[model samples]
Target: MIESMTPEQESNKPKRQFNNLVNNPVMEDYSLRYAPQSFRKWSEYAVATSALGGIAYLADFAIGASIFVTYGFASGVWAVILAAVVIFLTGIPIAYYSAKYNIDMDLLTRGAGFGYLGSTITSIIYASFTFIFFALEGSIMAQGINVYFGLPLPWAYLICSLLIIPLVVFGMTLLSKLQVWTQPIWLVLLVAPFLAILFKDPGAYGAWTHFTGNAKGGASVNFLSIGLGAGVALSLIAQIGEQVDYLRFMPEKTEKNSGKWWTAVISAGPGWVILGALKQLGGGFLAFYIFGALGATLAVEPIQQLIKGFGVLIPAPFIALTIATVFVFLSQVKINVTNAYSGSLSWSNFFSRMLHWHPGRVVWLFLNVGISLLLMEFGVFGFLNTVLGFYSNVAIAWIGAVVADLVINKPLLKLSPSYIEFKRAHLYTINPVGFGSMFIASVLSIIAFFGVLGSTAQAFSPFLAIVLAFVLSPIIAILTKGKYYVARPDALGHSAEEGDTHALNCVTCTDDYETPDMTYCPYHEGDICSLCCTLEKNCHDMCKKPGVIEVSMRK
Candidate 1:
């Protein structure tokens, strides 16, 4: 056939077309595939440092103040510790799998127990966390700008929201550099004020511990108050998703770097709560100090707390305000970029699965930021407590289900598959194991949150979600008999044991892809890439045999 073709005819033959939508490094960020070993080229420490930089957000300060003011110091202190322990424990497995498997949280959720369409629900939930935190962090930045430059709050909000767009549009490439470059200065400003206070006023700790806050509990700890505060604090449990987004870039582990690899994974993964816990505790102390100096209203504002704290070091009010604004602006920008970046990836996964079309992740970037800007204008800061308290229920239910599949159902009961299989052709649309447990837990906890289960349950809404989802996931897996775990053999049949180097040309996209992203397409009678398969809604899953289980059976 080649000998028969004229030179011009052979020259005019079509070249393979790469799917721009799926292959764009800026847009996809490996959203739907295993992050190829080639792309995971950074040192373990560099990736971990970049991931850790996002934890420098000021929301902890605000969260600390709000909880302490409502629950008093003794209750708030215990609540913060409890929430940290839970977050640390839950974060470990989620982090390990993402780093080891080189997949984002949505992909991890799919393979864990929530099947194809089942994880789409979690995609939306994770997207909500990104925008909500974006708005909050942006609002704090706006408050700081107003404090420093006297700019109108609306304009400040716009500036804060828009500033992150350029940084996040390039995705991890730009973000990694930005985070590493800024880490040093952020750490300096972050710790200097706290250290100065401790050195200058050693008695502040005693006063803060004895402080009654605005509550009627006095200085003593109250069990009910502790529950309420922990519920508020546990709302941050979803933050591990953000951490793992970067962790998925960890270089492939080898014997040479095993020690460094393990250290980076643990410290940058679950150990984020160590710095986070300290920040919250420091924030509580600052809020109390500010309360004593200013009043209850001003104490809750992070900008005010920073200005007062920094004021101790710099005597001039003007200079102190400028320095404080710089600190707040840098911190907010660091976290908001992560929020926008992660949110875009989540929305990409969500809309591609739901609508079967992806305009590109950058489109979702603007959409996420626009919504967050509007939220900032609506004053999300004013409703922080109520919003976080309510959000904690759904967030915990989702995390609890994933963790249960990881720690309980997969090992203890042997009710879930050991391997993570995320491809659509190999997964059921819905897996009752994860979806059922999360749905039941979220509904029941929301009921408890509203006091339908009485005041005691109301205060512990998040705990109810944790317990119910953890207990229910395994039961559902056992009831369903582990049949929903994997729909078919891997796309390459033996891709895991033999590394998939053989490239297959996708029938629809006319592109070559590695086996992990390619699938057998009975409709086309040729191999198809995952993006093509996802976009091919017209096929109606005709590739599978008639009357077969929607959940594919392992071959």
Candidate 2:
């Protein structure tokens, strides 16, 4: 015996409605749903270029300089390399799954192990990463404006924050074109100063290699210094989320295009860390070269670093300053647009699950930028190391849990699903596998970070987070027998099957979505889109009740 919704019962249910912003594909960019095959029209190269464009951020320069200033050359260099390796390896599985599944990181997290509502906290963590980096990048831009244009920091922060809104409002429609067009000039400008330094001041390299700042042992590698430096650098582990935001638009892979597809995915996915590491090393060198002239406070600033690097090539100081300022402006705009765009998506996912309402992604964009602007006004740049070091603990735990589920639990242990299942109808509200592991790891790591566990533990707290989360995910999954992974089996046919482009009409929204984004709704007596399924409040998950069968749509 099973319950069914009668026609009269269905008629009385609330109809789904969305505002104009969510309805417009250009404005929406499928912020809360899977990107369909039709909308994924860009070539692999185009998507990869657009994704890589965000790497133009100058924060790497400041981060690298800060690490070197805090630790000696040996420790700082090793930390950057070590962090890059870890970021690259962890990023591979996440990037592959997101691109292959054509869903953003938030959606992937829901299916990977975090469950539906279990991923809400991760959304907040991801959103925090976006705004924190947005503020950091904004601060760098403001510093350039203060030096070159004589504008106050406050006015410059406001201008920088507002300028990115129009660009991000359109989402990928405009960002792809913008990235392709500006990439050439940005690359040329990026390499010019480094090349000039190599030729004009070759001796600076030797000087930089021997330079020691506030490290305990001058010019020698300290394990503690390396661990601390790596912790600050690992804060960028969440950067993969921003990359996946663009990678979700990657076109479907086929036998004819498999090579190009993999190349694009790998290059734009985890390959971001390769270039990131180089930029950080360059930043360290520039800071070292300019350290004597600029002192500690100014040496770590990207604008000052570049101004000195360009001075090696340009005889005129005004011309060098102008070029450095232009580069800073260009870099900030490119990265901030990504930060704002990704933040909006994260916030939308978070609030939709919590409040069951989505005003639109555009509304969240303003909120993200507004928070970043406040951080800049407070001069967050001064505490760069402190801010990033603390953030890495929670971020690493989140990423570690997701990666373990993707690589270990799914593939090795077979405790998770073979494919991603993100629909609200099929998922439980919470899955203790990833959520619990992240929670336990984050708490212990935070305690260690605050010196509760001793100095050694404090410096390597992020490492503790990753290791604990990674190991605990499978243990939890096995203990729970993987029952909580999905609340109900997907009654809908395999939407991920090869060449299955069949579109299903969502009864609630009266819109056509691909099979992947459609799920059978017992309450509606028809297929419902994921967004509508997520927003339905009256059903109370009747589909998941024992012996409650969903109406078949086989006819």
Off by over 4 Å in 2: 1-9, 495-499, 550-555
Best by TM-score: 2
Tell me the whole-model lDDT of each prediction, alpha carbons only.
Answer: 0.86, 0.92
TM-score against native, each model: 0.93, 0.98
lDDT of 2 by residue, 389-458 (tens): 9999999999999999999999999999978888888989999999999999999999999999999999
What value does the lDDT take at residue 525 in candidate 1?
50
RMSD of each: 4.6, 1.5
CA error at residue 10 for candidate 1, angstroms: 21
**What TM-score should be assigned to candidate 1?**
0.93
lDDT at residue 337 of model 2 (Cα atoms): 94
Global CA lDDT computed for model 1: 0.86
Instruction: Please name the candidate that would achieve the greatest lDDT relative to the true structure.
Output: 2
